[model samples]
Each structure stands twice: as structure tokens, then as C-alpha cells.
Target: MAATACGTGSGPGGRADGRTERVTSLTALDYYTDTTEHAHWGELLTGCGEKAGVAVEHRSVPAPSLVPTALRQASAGTLPDLLMLDNPDLQQFARSGVLAPLRAYGVRTDGFGAGILSAGTYRGEVYGLAPTVNTLALFYDKRALAEAGVPVPRTWDELRKAARATTRPGRYGLAVDADASFEATFQFLPFLWSNGGDERRLDDPRAVEALGLWTGLVRDGSVSRSVLTWNQADVHEQFLGGRAAMMVNGPWRIPALDAAEDLDWGVVPLPVPRAGDALVTPLGGEVWTVPRNDSEARRRKAAEVLACLNGPASMLALADWHHTVPSRPDVAGRY
Candidate 1:
């Protein structure tokens, strides 16, 4: 099994004075440039920081700028006391030894979903955990599909058929990001994983089949060629403008979707390759980490804030605020 490690220790954080250091403030870094997202995080960080007996100096950057910022911080030996990395980048950061292994700080990882754990693990140890995680889903205009007498699709065949039936004079039936970027890969993974396409074997016929499914949608005019240039935000805009009836997106778009002009949207699991096949979508979220610091007490205090931020109630609150599912399945029930 490709499982993330969950063990306990209290060894690493920072090397501080032998005496416990008093931390007045801790630096926190995240990529939550969206006004609502940034504010929500600020409120949560304040509450958690208070509980940890430290004030938080929170800073946010655009999502695209986060990795570069972290890289610069790492090189300068000035990584924030706390870091929030999109899951894919967590392991690499952890592997570089700049991140303090979360378990060492008495943080629990007992009930996070496998995918989230997988993304935050390096070698056999977990270095981070998210408060809320998201995954791709099939989002349809409920009214449009209902008006067209089409139900939600459950398999590749049904998805193709629904897309075909919904295609109209000014609108495409479906849309996705087909650009050559990680966003495209993110949007493609559900189809690939659902069809049993292993990332380790790109030569596998299942992988080709999954690719064919997406290309076939475009070839058949069910999807626009614009997908080649569009990203998820573009796709979301298209869906909101009624230029696409269905999209492969996630709940992170829900806040915007809710604010749109009277669009009734419904979400379902991404379509499977075949009926009865389990839907397997890529996990999307940011994981919190405590960086290696010079002060052990400060590092430990930062870990306290990290833990406080991910407590059950905090998880639910953030998940609700972000329109995402809580990282811990047990805590998700309350949201």
C-alpha cells in the first residue's frame, strides 16, 4: 500500500536556547489571494494563534507565486514559521529537509483521506496536513440538464452522450482545461485514474483510452477547441455564462457559482470509465507545515497553531468557508 507515515516524536522543530523561548509572533505564509479566502484564513489564523499563545503575521501571495516565494525563503534561511503548501509541493519541500516532520510535533494524521496523506508524504513520513481538501467533480447546470431531459452521467459513454445532446447553437455541452500545464493534468487525472491508468506507466493502453475520451469530446464538437488555451478559471467562467452546460470542476468554485446570476448548479462524482467503477479524483488542497526554525520553542509554538487551526471545529469552519470538504472525514460530517 502507498500509505503515508503516522508516528510520534518530539525531536525536530528548531534548535533554540535550552530554556523555553517565549514567542511573541510567528510568521505564516499561504497563497490565498482571493479576498474571501484570504479573509477567512485571517480570521481562523487569529483564533488559532491566540490559542497557541502567539500572534500571527499572516501573508498571502498569488497561487502561482507561492512556490517561487517558498524557494526564495528556503534559500535565505527565512522560511516562515508556518507554511501552507499546495499538497503536490509538500513532499518535495519535506524531502529537502526544510520542513519539520509534522508527527514529531504531536500532530495527528489518523483520519485524513488517503489521497491527501499521499500528497503530503515524503519517503515514509508525513510533513503536512490540510484542514480542507477538494477533488474534481462533474458540475452541470441543473436547470439546463433538466430542461433538456438529460440526467447526470455515470460513465464515459453517458458523459459523451449528454455532452452531445446538450450542445447547442451558442454553447458547448462540456468544457475542461486541456492546456499543457499542471491544471490540465489536474483536470485529466480523474479520467485517467478512474480508467486504471497508472502514472508510472504512460505507455499503458488505459492511459491512451483516457486521453482519447477527452480528445474525442473535442473532435465531436461536444467540447470547444478553446479548452486548449483555457484553464479552470476560464472553464468556470464559460460554465457560468452558459457557454458550457457541464464542466469538470470542484467545490472551490462553489462560492463564485453561488454568487452568479440564478444559475442552478449540481455536482456529482466524476464519471467513471464504466458503470460500477469507482471514481478516483486527484486531491486538491494546501497542507500546513512548520518550517525548521532556530528557536525550538517558536517552532513548537507554530506547530501548536497548526494543530489548533486543524482541530475538528476549525476544520469544519474553514471547509464551510472555502466550499471544500474537510480533510478529516470525521470532521466533515459537521460541515
Candidate 2:
């Protein structure tokens, strides 16, 4: 269904206690912290609402800052009929009873990616829906590596060697975001994983090792000290402009990288530090949910909206439109 297929405004009159009340009005807070996400969400929500017979309103809030406000609002009985949140934030809110359990409403996680599904689950209850996927991985310029006589690094030590070998007077070896935004966590995660560390236990020896590995790059001149001021855009610019040879980024940059006329780049999973060390980075994505309310008709309408958002045809359409992996693995290739 399309936007034109759905009727606009409250039917007959704008009464809050009549048949119009049964027509659910859902609001979605965009968890994506970028302008591109805003545009994509506008399209997706519009199409989904048109198809599902619901009215959707959306607001933008930074991912890190939306949790407390959403929770406070939910507790005050002013909860949005729908919410967009991150996996970690969703889990936290679900555990605190701010989000209603989706199991009773026929929401299922079995259709989503395994990693995304795990992120949405807290104990045995599933409280959120992941409709997009993203993660940080190592990105390298193939030509730079070959010209510099360096191989794509598969381990931390090798990575250091490659960085050292790739550096020149005008170009840096490696670059990463070190700013205060959520992007900093992306820059840090690969290092943490390579050293067997995590944010939950910062005092761990492995954690220190991870931090040291990152600081060591600066000390050894493999990474610039100015990274402390870099954000994701800065790091991206450095790579694209040939001022940096290696960095960590996600699939979202694939289009830009592909369009670069002079750069030759490829992506690989995050590398390890020790011989046996395994690398797993933090995951980031959006979770869409229907809020708790008193009307069964409204709840059903919300369910229909979610179905349209999660449906096979709609998911594939959205994935293609937004350059993202659809929530269902089966339809990912369509993107």
C-alpha cells in the first residue's frame, strides 16, 4: 500500500473519545544520530503508515540522550504509541518495565539476524525489533597496501607494521575518531576486542591492554595524536582524501568508497591482537516498538503498522531505498 491509499486525518470528527480514538496514532523517535537517517525514516514511516492504516508522527532525539526522556514520558502515561531505540537502550528500558513485552502482541525475533536478535533479548523476554544492522570493521586501501609493500593486517602486531610501512610525509598510517560522541566507542571497540576487553569491565587487564594498544599507536606515530579531536566525518575525510591509509568504518560508507575515483579500498572484519585473540565489535542499530495503551483497536492498528514495517516486500523496499541491510537475512541480498 502507498500513502495515497490511506485516508488522512480523523474520520468524521476529531473526537478523542469516539471511533477516532480507535484509530491509533503512533509516534516514532528516530534513534539514528544523523540527517541521512532522518530522511530514510520519513520515507519508511510514511509508507508503513499508509499501508497499515495508522497515523505516525516522528521526532528526532540523539540515541544516547533519548533513553531517560522516553522512559520518563512512558512512566507519565504519555508514551508514544511507537518508539525507535537502540539495542542496549531497548534492553535497559525493557528490564525496567518501561517497554511492554512484545511476545503477547505477536512480535517475533526469529526473523531477524542472530546478532540483532540477541541484542534485543534481556533474559527470556524480547522487547524490541531490529530493522537495520551496522557494525565497525577494518577498512584498507588495496593500492596503498600494495604500493607501500604492506599486506592487509590480520593481527594487531601486523596492523602496526602495516601502519608504520604505509605512513609518508603527506599521509598518515592510521586514523580513528576519538571525540566525545558515540563514534568514539566505534574507534575503541576493535582495539578492545583484539585485547579481550570490554566496556563493562574497564579495570580488566585486557581492557588496559586494549587502551594501551590504542595509545601505543599514538606514541609510535602510527596514529596521530590529533585523533583526540576527530569525529567519524573527519576520519572519513582523511581516508577519502588519501591523508590516512587505514581506519575502522561500517558498510554505510561503501557507496562513497565505491564512488571514489582514485582510491582502491576493501573492508575486512576487525583483526585480532594475539595469535589466538578473536575480534568482535560493538553492534549498533535501531529498534522499533509499539507502546502500551488502553485501546485494543489502537493496539491492533499499531501491530498492523509494525507488520508493514517488518513485512517482506516493505523491508526489501526500505533496504534498497536506504542502502541498508534489511532486518530479515533472507531478503538482505535484495539490497
Candidate 3:
């Protein structure tokens, strides 16, 4: 956890007798509100806290409320000693000057993938780190594909044909989170990036081509217009109910899909624009940070716990439990 070198010394108070007092407890907050998920995280934090010689008080809030709650706490000068933020929101909080730089606390910042490291960095300083991360993939119903005589797709042309072939009276060939929210953008990036479309230049021909593929599918009845209102969970529900033969989703859905005894499913990396083009998927995960607080001792203790959470053993355990990829390349290779 990197704390072995830092050493746990005096916490908040010093005695005239010269005996160092250790911090015995710390507070942590995150958005793992689902019962089982929350419990798993609670166990991990407790274990890490034990290694750091402290007890951790772990709490969770709804995902959408996390940022707002954190901001309010920061304003009140009461942010949790250890905090978790969605990767995309880390920059905003770091820029707000409420997160302490991880390096400053002696937390190891190397050995992570470049994209994930960038996600945690603000103004050239790394402020957060995630044990595991995830990205999108194409999940298809094996029975449906077999019935349609379509093989798993590897290119845009194959995907379009497969989708069209799999469409039936009660089921759309493909489903995706296409609601007017960031979920839609998250699902759309692979197509846009793989097609050589730049978000900075939506007017590019490649961007138009990417949009046309999605629109074309809906027009051809291979994708439902209702996708305009569906979020990721809704798309997963549609797939589970057999109303969609294939869906664009992430590995986090694997547990639910595995629980459907009658369903036979397969997943593959998202199809690219061409056979040789690289598929570019958006990175997704939550990062843990030590929020700036009044007590240096408390912050240091929190950093020790943070380091423990990001340690190799913890990363592998998290990746296995959550069906995610480890953030460190070496850990990911082993995973």
C-alpha cells in the first residue's frame, strides 16, 4: 500500500511523553448502492483499512447524487477522507482543489494504462486511481444468430447484414442505450472513433457516415426507434426479455446475463468500421481519491487505505468480482 515507507505516526494530537498516536478510523464514500456490490466494497475497504491500521466507515449514495453530495460536502468543509468519483468527474473535482494529489501522499502512480492514468490526472497531477475499469462490447444471442444463419460480426458490413437477418416480428435485431444522455454518447463513441470521426468535428464525412449507420438500421427495422428513450439498463432488459437479439453493453452486465438459465449468449469486441480498423471504445470506471481536509494525519491515513485498495492483490480481486479489467497493464495481462 506504500504506507510501509511512510510509517503510521502521530494522528491529530501529540503527547508530552513523546509517544506517537495512530489514527484508528477513517471515512470513505462511494456510489456502490446495490446491496451486494456495496457489501463487497465494504469488505474490501475494511480489509484495506485493517492493513493500514485503521477502521473504515464506508457509505454509499445513488450514482446520480454522488457528485452533488460531494460538492455540497466540499463546500461545508466536510468531504470524506477517502472519496470515489466517476472517472469523468474526477477532473472537475480535482480542478475544484478538493482532491489531494496522490503522488504527494506517496501513492504509486505508475504501472497503469496511459488512457486510465490520463483519466485520473488533472493539470499534470494524478489525483485518483481505479482498481479496475471496463469498456463496451457486443453481446449477442447465440440461438438467435444460429437461427438467422449469421455468424458473429467483425466488420460494419457484417454487422449490418447480421442485424437485418436476425430481425423478426417480436424482436429487433440490435439494441443500444440511445437516450438523450451521456449513455447514448458512450454507446456511440466506438462507431464514431472506429470510423475516423472526431468529436471535435462532427461535420466530418466520417461522422456523418457513423450517424448514417445507426439511422439506417432504424429505418430498416433492425433497430427500434424506442432506442431514443432507452438507457443501458433498459437495453439490457430488452435483451434479457428476448425482445432484442443483440445489445451493445459492458462486462458489468455479465452476472445478470449469466443468471438467465435459458439464454445462450456470446460477447466479442465491438465490430470495427472495416476488417482491419481498430475498435476504439470509451474507458469507464470509478477512481478513488483522498479529498483535501483539515487534518494532515487523517488525510495520510486515508491515502494509506487508498494505496491498499489500488494494490495489485486488491486490483485482481476487484476485477474478478466485478467482471472488469484491471487498470494496471501487468495486472490486466494476468487477469
Best by lDDT: 3
lDDT tens digits by residue: candidate 2, 1-335: 11212334431223446655447356666555566656666677777776665567767776556777787787887777677776667776777776666777676567778777777777887767777677787789898889989889988888889899998887888888887766788678778866767789999999998887778888988888888988776888889999899987777677678889998898887778866767777776777776776655555566666766677776776566545677788878666
Top TM-score model? 3
- In order of TM-score, best first, we have 3, 1, 2
List the candidates' TM-scores in order: 0.86, 0.81, 0.88
Q: Candidate 1 lDDT, tens digit per residue, 16-36?
A: 345544566788899877777
Model 3 spans with C-alpha error above 4 angstroms: 1-22
Instruction: List CA RMSD, all candidates.
Output: 6.2, 4.2, 4.6
Give the C-alpha lDDT of model 2: 0.73
- C-alpha lDDT of all candidate models, in order: 0.84, 0.73, 0.88
Residue 303 shift from truth in candidate 2, angstroms: 3.0
Candidate 3: lDDT of 247?
96
Select the stronger candidate by lDDT from 1 and 3. 3
Decide which is better by TM-score, 2 or 3.
3
Model 3 residue-pair collision total: 0
TM-score-best of 1 and 3: 3
